[model samples]
Target: MHHDSLHALLVKEKLSLTRPRRIIFDLLLHKDPQSMQVLISRAANKVDRATIYRTIELFERLGIVHRLNIGWKYKIELSDLFVGHHHHFHCNQCGATHTLQANPMLETMIDTVAAKENFSPRSHQLEIHGLCGQCAGQPA
Candidate 1:
């Protein structure tokens, strides 16, 4: 999404488009998923850790981003409201994360299971944690 549109979103939410928030938003806008450490280090204007953490918490609370917990740590990215429904391949060895495209077969399986259990499903998330290509000693 455009930065202007993001600004408008903040306006609609009656939230201030603060400099730290804007920097964090732009970071998530381009990348897929990023760790807090990566975000703190990559922020252009050197936003402090406490401010970035608070911004991330705020975004998650507002449904603007999804927090994918990796053990005690986590990564943050734009939620499905802004992006498409998909899964994640998280590298256990190196902590790298790669996006997995949405699969129709998986959707079919989920629907089948829900029908069998008579369950009403609203939303779901999947994260496959293992060694990524590079960590597995192959091309990434």
Candidate 2:
């Protein structure tokens, strides 16, 4: 997303575009979902740990970022506003991951299932875990 959009979002929310926040935002932009530790490492001498955590929390609450949960652990990424809604594919053996774009058929199935269960559909996430092609191609 554009810097102007970020500034507009903050202005609309009555929040200031602080330096730390900008640093964090720039780090996340055009990036894949990654852990906070990875983000902290990338930030290096820029933003501190606590501030990054707080800013991430704020961003999550403001829909600026989406948390991808793998059981209890999670990674953060730019929200749909910045990167369209998507699922995930994980290689359990190599710990590699790939982004899966939202599929209309899959979404229709989800909506149908929710309707059957009399539940309102808000959002959903799916993670398929298995060996990636390269790993699978390798002999045991």
Best by lDDT: 2
Per-candidate TM-scores read 0.85, 0.91
Over the full model, what C-alpha lDDT does candidate 1 score relative to the true structure?
Answer: 0.84
Off by over 4 Å in 2: none
Cα error of candidate 2 at position 74, Å: 1.4
Candidate 1 TM-score to native:
0.85
**Residue clash pairs of candidate 1:** none
Q: Which candidate has the top score in TM-score?
A: 2
lDDT of 2 by residue, 64-117 (tens): 998888545788889988888888988777766778889999999998999899
Measure candidate 1: CA RMSD. Answer: 2.5
Provide backbone clash counts, one per model. Answer: 0, 0
**Cα lDDT computed for each candidate against the true fold:** 0.84, 0.87
RMSD of every candidate to native, in Å, equals: 2.5, 1.6
The 10-residue segment of model 2 with minimum total lDDT is 90-99
lDDT of 1 by residue, 1-140 (tens): 46676677678889889888888888898587988888988984668888998988888887888999876888899988778889999888887889999999997788788879988888788889999888999635
